[model samples]
Target: MANIFALITGLIFGFGLALSGMTHPEKVLGFLDVAGQWDTSLLFVLCGAVGVTVVSFRFITKLKAPVFAPIFRLPESNAIDKPLLIGSALFGTGWGISGYCPGPAVALLASPNWELWVFLPAMLLGYVLHWYLFKPQAQKSAAAAPENTKAEPPTCG
Candidate 1:
């Protein structure tokens, strides 16, 4: 049941991305090209998303449990750490260059493009490399941390 809900949610999100021209690299690039012929259409999309999130998140966080889960799991940390900064910089640089963030990139996979053929595999390779480089360090840090300081593992439920 939870899986079905997740699938439905993902389909709706993908549909929204497609409808909003988010799946088009050209459209995204146009939006990013500030000095050139700028496209402000995607700005409305971003504003709409942010507005909705700002309004909905307050109510959502107040709930004792999520609709499909026993607990309302949320991020425990709000720290602006080195890893967070580095990851943000990398993500922004990639998005600025390719004009396709992960969500829209995945959505575009339904209607495969020449760019996606390159981007998807590269994205997957990046994931593998990040895991390989960071996994051991993460494991060691987790092992060294005091039990009381350790955060509870996030669950899909």
Candidate 2:
């Protein structure tokens, strides 16, 4: 049931990406490029997304748990740390260079692009590197740390 929901959600998301012109690397790159010919359409798309999330999360969080999941999953990190800063820098740099993020990159596989030849390989390399190099250390650190450390217990209102 959850898998079915995920499948439907992914399909809808991919369709939305395709409809929004986000599947095109050129379009994404254009939005990032400041000095060159700029495309502001994606800004509206991003703004719309932010707006939706801002509104939806407020209401949705009122629910005790997620509709399709056993637990209420959400990001607990709010502080800017060294890892966060560095990772964000790397992500931004790669996105600026290739105009490809993971979601759109996967969607790109549905279409054909020369950049995907470069993007997909590099993306996979990053994933492999993270899994092989960082994941074990991360897991050990997580295991060593106390549980429920990332977030505090919710207060009774």
Candidate 3:
């Protein structure tokens, strides 16, 4: 049942990405380009997304549990640490250079362009490498860490 909802949502999201011109590399790149040929069209898309999320999340938080899930599985961490900073830098750098984040990249794959071929493989490789290198150590550290070290609950504004 969850998988069905997931597929439906994914299809809707992909269709939205396509309709919004997010699947086009040039459109995404143009949005990122600060000095030349900067396209403000995607700004509307961003604003619409933020607007919907801001309105919807207000109602979403009022629900006792998610419709599709028993519990809300959210990230526990609120700390702005070195790993977070580094990961953000890496992600931003990649987005600026390639002009396609993972979501758009996957949506763009319907056309199967050469750029998507390169970017998708590299992206998957990065994920695999991160898991291979860090997952074990992360698990070990979590296991060794004191049980009393609870992360602070996030404060809503």
Candidate 4:
């Protein structure tokens, strides 16, 4: 039931992205080009997303648990750390260069653009590289930490 809900939600999100022209790299690039012939259409999309999140998050967080889960499983940490900073930098740089962030990139896979062929493989490679380089260190750190001092792993839900 949870998996079905997730699939339905993902399909809706992808459809929304496609409808908003977010799956188009050129449209995204145009929005990013502040100095050149700038496009304001995506700004409305951003604003709409922010507006919905701002309104919904307040109500959503008030719930005892998610609709499909027993527990909320929210992020415990609010601290801005080195890994967060580095990851943000990398994400921003990639988005600025390619004009396709992960959500939109995945959404575009349905249509199979030429850029998607390159971007998706590169994105997958990045995931593999990050896991290979950092997963062991994370495990070691967690193992070395005292039981009471260790934090729970972050979750999306």
TM-score for each predicted model, relative to the true structure: 0.88, 0.85, 0.86, 0.87
Report the Cα lDDT for candidate 4. 0.85
For model 1, how does the per-residue alpha-carbon lDDT over 1-157 read when each residue is reduced to its tens digit?
8899999989989999999999998899899999899999999989988899899999999988888878776765677899779988998899889898888879987999788999988988998898789878767767898874345552221
The local lDDT score (0 to 100) that residue 9 gets in candidate 4 is 88
Alpha-carbon RMSD of each model: 3.4, 5.2, 4.7, 3.1
Instruction: Name the weakest run of 10 consecutive residues (lDDT summed) in model 1.
Output: 148-157
From the highest TM-score down, the ranking of the candidates is: 1, 4, 3, 2
Query: Compared with the true structure, what per-residue lDDT tens digits does model 3 show for residues 50-106?
Result: 999999989998899998878776666788999889998999998888788888888
In model 2, where do residues sit more than 4 Å from their true spots? 145-157
Q: Candidate 1 vs candidate 3: which has greater lDDT?
A: 1
Task: Point out the higher-scoring one by TM-score: 1 or 3.
Answer: 1
Following a full C-alpha superposition, what root-mean-square deviation does model 3 have from the true structure? 4.7
Clashes of each: 0, 0, 0, 0
Q: Against the true structure, candidate 2 has what lDDT?
A: 0.81
Q: What is candidate 2's CA lDDT for residue 57?
A: 84
lDDT agreement with native, every candidate = 0.85, 0.81, 0.83, 0.85
